[model samples]
Every structure is written in C-alpha cells, then in structure tokens.
Target: MNEKIKNFADSISPLIFLDFLFESRKNLTRLIIYFVISLGLIITVFFMQLSYSDSSRAGVINAFFIIICTSSALIGGTYSAASITSEKEKKTLTLLRMSGISGVQIIIGKIVSGFIYMLALSLPYLVLTLLLTLFGDFNFFRLAGGLFMWAGFTFFYLAAGVLISVLFKKNASANSFFYFSMFTLHFLISLLDEWFYRPLYDYSSYKFFTNLSPIDVWVNFSSSHLYGSTYYGNDGISSLFNGTVPDYAVITLLYILFSIILTLFAANIFEKYLRWRED
Candidate 1:
C-alpha cells in the first residue's frame, strides 16, 4: 500500500512540475497580454458608456461582459492543444513519449497548464466583477455564483476543444473543428428553441433554451433581475428563462462530469493512435 501510494505520488509529481515549468516559461506572458488587453477594453467601454446608460441596463451589460471574459477562456485550452500538436509536428512528442511519461500524464499535464493559464488570464475579469459589486447592483452571492457557473461551463467547452485536438493531426484543423463544433452547437440550440420551444411554452421558452446551453447557466443564474420575467423567444422547454434560477448544483455537476468523461475519452483515443500519427 505504501509503495502504491508513493508510486502514485511519484507519477503525479513530474506532470505537476512540468505543467508548472511550462506555465512559468510561456503562459505568464500570454496571460499578462490577454489580461491587460481585455481589462483595458472592458474598463474603457464601461466608462465611455456610463453617462449614456440607465442603471438597470448598465448592470445587464456588465454581466454580459463578465460572461464574455469567462467564455473566452475556453480558447486557452484549444491553444494548449495546438501547442501539443506543434510539438508532435516537430517530432518532440517522441521524446516525451520515450521519457517514461504515461499518456495520462501528458494529457493531464497539458490540461492543467492550460487551466492555470486561463484562470490567470481571467483573474482581471473576476476582479472587475467584484468591483461592480460595490455599486450595489452586484451582490457577493451573485458574483460568486456567476464565477462558479462560468468556470464550470468553461471546463466542458475546454474538454471538447482538447478532444478535437487529440483527434486531429494539425493544430489548424483542430482549431477549425473546435470552432465549427461550437458554432453548430449554438446554432442548433437557437434554431430548436426558436422553432420548437416558443410554440410550446409560450412564455417558458427562455428556460428551455438556457438549460440547453450550459454556457448560459452562469449568466442567467446571476441575473436575479431577470427572474419571473417571460421569455418570448422561440425555443423548446419553457420554465427556466422566466427569471427562475435552475438547479445550479445539478448544472455544475453535469459540467464537471462532462469534463471528466470527455477528457478520459480523449485520453483513450490518444493512447490508441498517438504513436501511429504522422508528423
């Protein structure tokens, strides 16, 4: 038992160390750039639009920007997958493979690096959201809820992107595939909501659509002001968008489960064909 425990710890240590080293080497600069640019744009827009806005509408806009920042972090994982593919293209994957690093270690190390970098990139946005709470429109509970939802949903999307990268030979192809998958998901949901949900729920169309979109879970959850309001959009499964907060625990659990299952799935596929893939 002791030997098993030690072996497990030994196994994880190198991946964690590699993840940290890689993050320190490359991702710090990337995080700094993303944070500076995104925060600057958001702050500038908020101030520029402050004088023209009504308070209620301004709060909604703030929430929207917060969601955008959180959602954009999903791209970090996609970028990390491309970085792995680039290494594969350069034949460096062989070195890593030969170094006694298990396939699980490789995938998880890369995923952790990407996750850490994304959280760093998104810290500025979280701070900004906290600052908004001081204005009375945003509360602590709401802010926390939003962050939880955002991170959870981002995990799901990030896993999807990584899965695509594992399946594709080229980084460019992986990126295109991920984007196409995202677009198709949103489009199909929107179309189904518009064409089917609206006709069924009348005012309940919003809840159905939001439930379908794991991404919207946090955005809608923070929108206490939107509760009890009627959603007129054409979508199926009404009852969630009338400003009612869905079961956040269930949604969050679903997101976590989604990430784990997909990551395992990607790892399985990688282990099977990773050796045979041509650079």
Candidate 2:
C-alpha cells in the first residue's frame, strides 16, 4: 500500500512541479495582478466589517462567501482554460508528448495546478473570514461548510474549463466560451427557476433548480445553517434522502460527481485530440 502510494505521488509530483514553474515563468505578471486585486478586496472587506453592526456582520460574512465563490470560479476557469490552450498555442504540448508525458498526466496536472493556484488566491479571504467569525455571531460549521462548497464549485468550474480548452485550439476562444457558458448557465437557470419554475412547480423542483447555481447553494446553506431559517427546511427534498441531508449537502455531492465526470470526459477528449494530431 505504501509502495503504491509512493509510486502515485512520484508520477504526479513532476507534472505538478513543472506546471507551477511554467506558470510562474510565463504568467508571473498576471499572477501578481490577481494577487493584488485579491489583497485589495480583502482589505476593503475588512474595513467594511469594522463598520457593520453585530447583526449586519453576518451579512458581511455571507458576502465574503459569495465573493470568494465568484472570484475563484472566474479566475480558476480562465487559468484552467488557458493552461491547456496556451500549451497548444505555443506548441509545447507536442514537445511534452514527445518527452513521454501522457495526456492523462497533463490534464490532471493542469487541474491540480489550477486548483492550487486558486486556493492560494483565496487564502487571504479565507483567513480574514475566519478571523471575523471570532467576533461575529457566526456558526463555525456553516463557515466550514461554505468553504467546502466553494472548493467544490471551483473544481467543477476548472474541470469545465479543461473540457472547453480541449475543444478549442485558441486560448481566447476557450476563455470566451468558458466565461460565457458559466455566466449564461447561472443566470439562465436562475431566471428559469424564479420566473417559470418556482411559480409553477413544487418546492422540490424549485429547490433542485435553484441549488444548481453554486452561489444560490451557498446563500441558502448559509441562511438555513447559520441563521436557523427554514428557507430550505420546508422543502420536501430533504425527506427524499431519509431526512438526514440538507440541500447544500446534496448540491455538494452533485457538484463533486459532475466534476469527476467532466474531468474524465476532458481526459478522453484530450487523448482523442492527440491521436488525431499524430495521424
């Protein structure tokens, strides 16, 4: 078991290390820009929190979750999409392949590298939020759960970006498609839920569709878990899983499952693309 674990780590470490080096070498300026933006946002939120009343601080904390989720999703998606598309643009993918790096390795490495990069980008916000919980009337469990949800959402977006990158040859095209699809899906599904589904369908259906948006999931989860609200409790969806699960739990599970499926699909697409190129 130890030997197998060691072998797996050995296989992945090189790709992860090399990808980070490549990103630092090629995208250092962009990374610095993002880091500066994140730092500015964190500082702004900190001052805002200082002025909020005790009751309003919860709302501020909730806003932190949304900000993190949105920024991480957007940044992570762009980087993940560019990671592959840039390689193809520079024709480095072919060299990597010739150097005996498998397509699966490249895909997994890109995903992991993007995830790590986003996590680093989010660390400041995460730390500030945690510090806020010390003085605010916040539920620790809810804060932890929301962070977990954000991480899952980030993975899902990054995987989708990878899939998009595989489908497009140019970084610009892949990036455009990723951002458009992400915003479109979130807004379109949300509008459908609010305008058509909730007014016409049952709570279960409304809840399912609403939870499809990671932002909505985080908001609803924070409301129910932290504020002791019945926003999701009255819904019959909870009973479907033996009444032990919350809506966010179900949503997190679905996001994770979809992330795995999308990553596999991207890997398959990449392998096929490589074969076509060889031919």
- Which candidate number has the best lDDT? 2
User: What is the lDDT of every predicted structure here?
Assistant: 0.62, 0.78
For model 1, residues 156-177, the per-residue Cα lDDT tens digits are 6667777787777798888887
- Model 2: residue 100 alpha-carbon error in angstroms: 2.4
The estimated TM-scores of all candidates read: 0.70, 0.83
Q: What is the lDDT of candidate 2?
A: 0.78
Q: How many residue pairs clash in all the candidates, one count each?
A: 10, 0
lDDT of 2 by residue, 1-279 (tens): 999768766776787888778767788898789778878877787787876775566666767777888887788899888888888888887887886767777888889888887787788888778767776666777677778778888898889999999999899999999989988777666675566655564734555565577666776766765466534633435567765666776777788899999999999889888888889
User: CA shift at 117, candidate 2, in angstroms?
Assistant: 0.4
Regions more than 4 Å wrong, model 1: 1-65, 68-74, 134-138, 193-210, 214-219, 225-249, 275-279
Q: Cα lDDT for residue 140, model 1?
A: 51
List of clashing residue pairs for candidate 2: none
